[model samples]
Target: MRSTTPRIDVVPAPTPAASLVFTTVLTHGPLTRIEISRRTALSSAAVTKAVRPLMAAGYLVEDADEEARPSLGRPATLVRVDGGRALFIGVKVTGDEIIAVLADLCCRIRVARHLPVTDRDPGAVLASISGLVQELLTEAEGFGVEVRGLGLAVSGDVDRAAGVVRYSPFLDWRDVPLVELASTVTGLPVTVDNDVRALTVAEQWFGAGAGISDFALVTVGAGIGCGLVVHGKVVSGAHGVAGEIGHLPIDPLGPPCHCGNTGCVEAIAGDAAIIRRVREATGAPVTDSAGALELAHQGDPGAREAYTRAGEAIGRAIGAVVNVLGPQRVIISGEGLAAYDLFAEQIRDAFTASAFGTAAQCDVMTRPLPFEEWARGAAATAIQSFIGIDTY
Candidate 1:
């Protein structure tokens, strides 16, 4: 069911209609021509025209369903994306580690590798990344597939249009042209995006936000990050920083944030903030996130209180997003969910208490995603880039 490398067909670069038809099938197939027309708002003739080239290129296949007949005396066959046409690589870079996955055209993971970084310098991280990509390339050789693209996802201010990392606090990098560097090193087209935004894209295409016109994914952990999709597009803002609920001023008297702002949502709800509060309130020399979660689970009053406050802050931030955008859902995720039980009640309470009117009716759900899922998001970004559908 899984292979490190896959046999890739020589799929021609798709035209605009071809791209649309292929995406429609990949998301909502095996669909008939009539159904594809209804979903994409193209005429049946246009759908047929678009699908023909994709089918010839081996990117789409028609499944025979002779038993199923249309009213016009012709049997309608179902069309679906061919998952083996190409391969891509997606990598999520965290402060201390890199998680990379080799994925097929369908964005399914074929192989994954993780590397730890002892240094945050850009050169050191790039070297580690190159080694990992080379390993995956060898894996690709076994399948006789060419890896078409690479997606690199990192946190902090990212200028995705320019394929640059403007400022990555976790990586201690500034103005690094990541896409060009990675492309040169790996010999493939590359896309660089904000980690949370890349994750949102994956969610929009295949996860909880699928078919929804509007939604938000809020990540709580070392950093509190939000990714917003509205009116069927992820809002990257004019300066490439939108949906940054973490910097919203929620409490004037709250602790200072690394962004040099006092009382920001992230200042009150981020991991470091919670750990600092726990240490001060409990005098328990807790040094890291695991220790903080352990103390909270053990019923330590200070640890519990810290999480309670963080939950309140995060809830209010989500409330702000809902009040403004009115998304149909808000997905809560990230490594921080390991301690979700400690603060779940507080999050619910604060959200209900502060959300304005019908905004409270917006569904809020938490789905835990591991690091590999984030890497898959990176792969999704690469797919978007390859298809020339990248809006950001």
Candidate 2:
């Protein structure tokens, strides 16, 4: 039997200035009012006005900073988001499993659950999603705060504005009205987004990309995905697909992609592609990524060569991103980083060879983000939508 969906009480809409102040503090706090004013470019009076209502709502709190006492005036009172005031739920749907997290208003994951997805059908996925959400809602009851919103992140082309999954190759889904369906079942306002973009949002606010206005996150795993942040905003192309580095045709005669293209980056470097190449190269019954990785670690020349080629392909894609966008930094992430040791040299070599002269100077770094982080990213999107940010 299904549990009754909880009623959602919408938060009071904050003014533009108030929203800005709140986000600034949420990302970089506990800041003094003067510091918040300086960071947000709002005047002291404006910051005060913004802070007053948020504090009154119990969303923000002030703490006296005795150590920062000024000789001429009173000690500074630092303001920060009261994370315990509310809760949120975030879920990331992969082809084979679902990752869910219960997060505080600050987007901190208080609890996480993972469930294997045996069925790809929309109805089955929705049922699993609702079950996980109900579990989280029960968890939120312990904190005595409302679960304000739910966020869902999936891979492939997603129209966030329309709340639809236009095409998700992994799940073999198209035109699924995810937001409406999930919202109806979970009884909470929902935000739907591409998985990579959702992760970029979390990075922008709380991770490595924080404070960096221009950067790109390149995720290498089952698929090669790129998320771009330009001018302090995550750029969702006008047509809803941007930064698709995986589809770049680096080799015209290369392997065929699921997207019906030849020589696409993903066709050459994605996990399945790598596994196929490894099996063909070494004549090993390498059925999965782990098996292929094991062969490479065992010094199998063909398996090692496969990883090298994948690294080269990935590097070329990164070079393309750098030459075009000229971002200050490029963050290499995803589950594929487990094999970083096998292809680190090839990736660096190919990137240096393909990058334009000045573009070669772009800083490239790797960070391995767990599945839980991806779920947290989904939560961040919900927070963005709740705060009236341009999540779409």
Candidate 3:
């Protein structure tokens, strides 16, 4: 029987080198073949061979080299991905909201949509995903490009190979076949992945981790999540759950975690933890992280203390990760960065105190990113699948 589900039958990358060459161009594009060779370490012949199919398929294009030197004879043409060749939809499902984006082949977001989550049930979240994907699909048609695939990034343990969300604490879901569900609903192949891991893929290829062989991404907000890239590859762990720094036990007697643990990083530094601490400390009846931040910004001692503790917890958690994985760079991001100022000092102090030996020298920086960036990460995952480069 013919399948009703839409699929991109074309394999954009027939070999691993093809995938590497395409993404290298996508990230650092408009480069001469020689430069592509230098960056990818692929021989000139291999680079040309890999790019041939991509350019033929309209996924790549060539243009006269802009950095050409007349004295150096004929200019070398540059290769770049054709962003208009295809479209992808990326969805980021948070505990309170769903953020979706329509992205081009280059993983550039063309349109973004958001919907508040009134329910966290698989069925309800699926409905929200359906609506947002439909909107993006409609938008894709206007671009005259096929929406090749859909990607879903959710928080928790996700088996990308199986497309199953093993357990999502934020959504209280377990054993859900998200890819199967989303593909059925959207009529497009769906790639399901851990939200933080998906974001790490984007960073590894196109953002801060670009060209860095080892790095870590730590997101602080609804949850304290860490994504690690070691030896130029995103590590998903043997059990499909790596870099779960959020569950690191910092305070055995600190607070109860959603995972039934005491004083895990998430229990101390997650948004809910901050909100709960603020309410208890200040008796302010703060219901959200914003309200908690407002009190802290107003110089409330109790609120300030809450942030101080949270920051220390986060810093200590990061220290543990660094001590173990020895990542070269650690990037801190997410909506919770809004509260960074309140406890920046505490985090620095704690991290410095906890880091062992040269690990303290590792660069640690923060970049404030909206949820849309995570959605874009989801889009990147779709692009990976389309190019047959996904870890799977």
The lDDT values for all models are: 0.87, 0.91, 0.90
**Candidate 1 per-residue lDDT over residues 168-209, each given as its tens digit:** 877879999997777777777788899999999899888999
Q: Candidate 3 on 1-392: residue-level lDDT in tens? A: 11267665544666899998888888888788899999989998999899998988988899986577577677778889999988989999999999999999888889999999999999999998898888888888898888888889999999999999999998999999998888887889889999999999889878889889999999999999999998888899889899999999888899999898899999999999999999999998899988999999999999999999999999998899899999999999988999999988998889999999999999999988889999999999988888888453
Determine the C-alpha RMSD for candidate 1 after optimal superposition of all C-alphas: 3.7
Lowest lDDT sum, 10 consecutive residues, model 2, at 1-10
Clashes of each: 0, 0, 0
Off by over 4 Å in 1: 1-16, 66-75
For candidate 1, the lDDT comes to: 0.87
TM-score for candidate 1, please give it: 0.94
For residues 295-371, write the lDDT of model 2, one tens digit per residue: 99999999999999999999999999999999999999999999999988999999999999999999999999998
Per-model TM against the reference: 0.94, 0.97, 0.96
* Winning candidate number (lDDT): 2
Clashing pairs in 3: none
153 Cα displacement, candidate 3 (Å)? 0.5
Better of 1 and 3 by lDDT: 3
Which sections of candidate 2 miss by over 4 Å? 1-13
Q: Give the Å error, residue 313, model 1.
A: 0.7
Model 3 TM-score relative to the real fold: 0.96
* Model 3 lDDT, residue 185, Cα: 78
**Between the candidate structures 2 and 3, which one is better when assessed by lDDT?**
2
